[model samples]
Target: MLKGRIIKALSGFYYVEHEGKLYETRARGKFRKTHETPLVGDIVSFQIENETGGYINEIHARKNSLMRPPVANIDQLLVTMSMKSPEFNYYLLDRFLAYGEAHDMEPVIVVTKTDLGNDVGKLEEIKNVYEGVYPIHFTDRNNINENLNDIFKDKLNVLSGQSGVGKSTLLNTLVPGLELHTAEISNALNRGKHTTRHVELVEVGGGFIADTPGFSTIEFSEIDKYNIKYCFPDFNAYSDDCKFRECSHINEPKCGVKSAVESGQLAKSRYDSYLAIHQEIDNRKERY
Candidate 1:
């Protein structure tokens, strides 16, 4: 059996790349019983059959996975958001951040399409909230290409955002002929038409990038209310200062996170998003 990494899965075949060559392959039958379908970005073992495809024999462990895009073992997520179309949304941004933090993937805040939305001040407003908590790259049509390589350098990064946030446009800019289809935000839908339908890794800038369908919403299925606080990095430094060891930061008196929010030490929007998500998780717990 030869070892390879699955770069794409189409129809019923898995496309595994090994030694610079792609081997069209299929997962072993046993996977069906286990309900384990081979996922893109999975390192798999298979047997090559001359010219015909191959059969994947085993799948290796993954570092992380996202249910929304259904990709695995990614190093970081380029969390792209638009400053104009669809507008800036802290709740959505915080949700992506929480998901990234929960799965141990580094989150890079990338604001694209600053020029399209006609809102000049929106960019600064976005930076004021996220820059303090994460590394942010603010780009427009003018210079996104120049910075693409640096953001994608040496990491298996996923190009992700909500539909029509310029995820494909960004990829096309990085690779001249990539030619990923792009569309304007539908006036009816108020969001970009979904241009990317599947997950496939494209080799670019000394690294691999998986352009996934943009996600407008994400659920905290893997995390519960009690532990969700830790996903917010801003909350970590102050959680230790709370009066009680188990303080949830919402209602607890002398809670460090809340106090920081009240005093402007932390972005009020960030705290509000956290509390909103916290309540969502709380609501989820009571449902069962």
Candidate 2:
């Protein structure tokens, strides 16, 4: 058997990449019986039937995967958002960051439509909050490709963000001739319609990127109160100094996370997001 990674899934074919060559293959009948769908990022063992065809015999375990885009073994997430139209939001970005961390994928922030909004103060504020914690990039129509190669180099990156936030536009900019469809925000609904319909891993700049259909919101189905704290990268060092060993930082006295929030050591927005997500998790658990 030969080892290769599935780079794309179209119709019923799995385009596997091995040794700089793409082989067109398909899964066996047993995979369907087991209800196992081969995702774009799956590494599989296959047998080459001839010069151009084969069958996937086995699938390797994945490090992490996202449900919305349905990509697997992702190294990082390029969280793209717009500065206008849908409007720049810190809370939404926080959610993306925390969720990516929870799934063991690094998150990089990309702010799009910079020239449209002309909000310098807002941009600076976004940068200042996440300056040391995460890498952030800004782009406009004229120069959307700047500094993008370093962010996505040699990683399986999932490109995602809310609708009308320019996820497709930025992707097309990074990979010219992609020609991904873009939509304007609906004045009546105040959101953009989904432009991307399915997820397919496209290779560029020595990396694999899957552009997902833009979504308006995401829920924390997997996260719980106890584990959400680890999702915030900024709280790692200070969490040990808390009065309690397993501090949630909501009402716990002398909690290091809370102290940082009070002393301005941590961004108030981030702490608030943590609190909100924690509450949401608790609320969700209570409902079920």
Across residues 212-249, which tens digit of lDDT does each residue of candidate 2 receive?
54344678887788999899989987888899998888
Clashing pairs in 2: none
Residue by residue across 1-288, what tens digits does model 1's lDDT show?
899888887778889989899999988899999888788889999998877778999999899876556678888878888886777778787888888888888888888876775665666777777777888987776677466577667678876667767777787777677676676533225333332235688888887787653455678877899888888998888888899999989888989888888888788888888888889988998998
Task: Show the colliding residue pairs in model 1.
Answer: none
- lDDT of the candidates, in the order given: 0.78, 0.80
lDDT of 2: 0.80
Please name the candidate that would achieve the greatest lDDT relative to the true structure: 2
Cα misplacement distance, residue 42 of candidate 2 (Å): 0.4
Give the lDDT of residue 95 in candidate 1: 82
RMSD in Å for all candidates: 3.3, 3.0
Number of clashing residue pairs, candidate 2: 0
TM-score top scorer: 2
